[model samples]
Target: MEGMTDAPESQKRALRAELRERRRIRTASEREREGTALTQHLIDLTSDLGARSIAAYLSLPEEPGTRDFVEWACENGIRVLIPVSRADGLLDWAPYDGSDEDEDLLGMPTPTSELLGPIAINSVDLIVVPAASVDRTGMRLGWGRGYFDKTLGSMENCPPVYAVIFDDELVDSVPSERHDQRVDGVVTPSGIVAF
Candidate 1:
């Protein structure tokens, strides 16, 4: 991750608030267009990498949506695993059936199917995570929760992990700590960028 954070937790909170507001102000059409482009970029990347199984997240309203990409992956015989947040800050995985019928946890949609436990991430070839922002150095700023940080750290030999964000969310720097696992790359509407 980025060497000791230049900003404190309070600054991180302020940045998150500003980014969330900007995301919330976007029109539905703009979000849809960006989501579509993002899906295409991801599809191309996965195809290039020959990935069969991917661990992904169900995006929130203000975050770049992944439902379309998840459905497309399933239709094309790619296994898609989604996360279910646990009270202890760990993630439980479940196969995505391309259904929007899910419950909200901490304001984000989660699968209600039989959980496959957190280790399920170990079997996936790639991981697609949600991030509020990421730095050029690959440090990810999550929604103040350490779920992904914990999950990624626990993986045996974790596959290539990627964070999905909007075009503007990819920046020059973000506050990150030692425990925060850095991603291999980021996927935005414009294209994918690796650190």
Candidate 2:
């Protein structure tokens, strides 16, 4: 059993190195194309699931895609939530309603809405997460802030976690520390990837 665990860890480290190298070579145009495709894929997934309430993340510089899923969710009457980071490295969710104006939080654009309040993780039916990279086993590599890890740890019966990544960023493994949270699914430019 110990050997089994070590094998995955070893593979994950190797995959992480490979992906980092690939990302270093990606151009601006390539990122744009991947982002558009990923956005569309997420929209399709949300529609298919008929998710009435979802908690999604605001994208960062390296992650591909826009918040079209949030807009679509609002139009379809599905409540959307985005994480608001606290100083202690935990995520507090705020509801997202469609609005042209958004608030800038930690350099990310967050939707402006009246649905601001404390959200119980169990109350959310679905969750869309942002990732720098993801592996086949649904493990995600974030910006290394440990924010999502701490937040997810607090949940007893949380919603399904979906990591959104560019197609090229999806690999067979990713280097995961003991504190890293494993996502339940991955949404890339091509399609939905389930571990």
Candidate 3:
């Protein structure tokens, strides 16, 4: 029964590999179309939550794109805080510059502004995070990196956290552990659902 309850690490690795392959094969046009829809989903969500300040990410080409939503937030006068990678494997925050030119080494687009430090995440009204996959229980599987995990765990007065992923990335279950923080909801190209 214990074996049936949680997937082994091997199973999770295999699922990650499969999903990576799928993302690799997806075309740019397809990703753009999906991004457009996802932008709307995020917009509606921000409205319903009355989020004036949002913590979100700049996506890679393969990930569910959040550039549109980030730009929208900036245009609409919503304070947008993006992450900067830190040497300690934690993330620091910076305001989005609403530019198409800035990016970090990992191909993750970033802002070229003064970093507001890690604790700045606590000030946001909502969080939109990237995920390799998320289960029905809102368990997010990251790329074996504990950055988001640490971020979510450290917040004392945390806001609602949502994992942003492509449509098929939301699955039945993902391997879970004591340190893995669950999200409040998920945002896909199709729609949104809270866990």
Candidate 4:
């Protein structure tokens, strides 16, 4: 019975490896085109949701881009908060007020502004996250990182959380564990997919 508990996690690891390879091989021009489409979709989502404040991530090069959308949101007076990882496995957020950038504990790019406690996420009307893949049911598969799962699980009054991915990453099924959390929807280069 105990061995059963490891099955999903092992399956997730293998799947993540495959997804990472796929993303890593995308051409730069293709990524740029996808980024443009993704930016428009994110803008539309925030507009539709009437979200004045949003929590989002700084995308890595291989991931679907979020920088253009973040830039647009800040320029338009919409508040944006980027996550900073803590050693305790919780996320602290910082306002991205068109400020300079710094690396978070995990070395991800974050804002250089003052840090806000973990609960700061509650104030956001929308949250956009990065994912290796998200299933049709909204189950997100990250790169073996539990940070997002922990954050989403601990939220008591979480707003709409969405994952950013390319269209192909939206799979029919993904391995899930008891601790894995689901997003409310996904934003792909194709469009927004609501679960």
- Expressed as tens digits, the lDDT of each residue in 1-195 for candidate 3 is 777745656676787898899999999899889989999999999999999999999888788889889889999999999988777888988888597446654556678888788999999999999888999999999877789999999999999999998888999988877788999999999999899
Per-candidate Cα lDDT values, in order, are 0.87, 0.73, 0.88, 0.93
Candidate 1 per-residue C-alpha lDDT over 1-195 given as tens digits, one digit per residue, 9 for 90 to 100: 443454567678999999999999999999989999999998988898899999998777778988788888889999989888888888888988786557646656776677898888899999999998999989999888899999998888999999999989999998777788899999999999988
Q: Pick the candidate with the highest TM-score.
A: 4
Please tell me which predicted candidate would have the highest lDDT against the true structure: 4
Taking all chains together, each candidate's TM-score versus the true structure is 0.92, 0.78, 0.91, 0.97
Evaluated at residue 1, the lDDT of candidate 2 is 89
Candidate ranking under lDDT, highest first, comes to 4, 3, 1, 2
- TM-score (C-alpha) between model 3 and the true structure: 0.91
lDDT of 2 by residue, 1-195 (tens): 888768756765676566667776778898777877887888877777777888886665555665666777788898777777656666666677766446544656675654354444558778887776877888788766777777776678877888887677777767777778998888887888877
> Per-residue CA lDDT of candidate 4, range 1-195, in tens?
978998988998898898889998999999999999999999999999999999999888988999999999999999999999999989999999776998987889999999999999999999999898999999999877798999999999999999999999999999998888999999999999999
* Distance from true location, Cα of 155 in model 3, Å: 0.7
Ranking by TM-score: 4, 1, 3, 2
Candidate 1 TM-score to native = 0.92
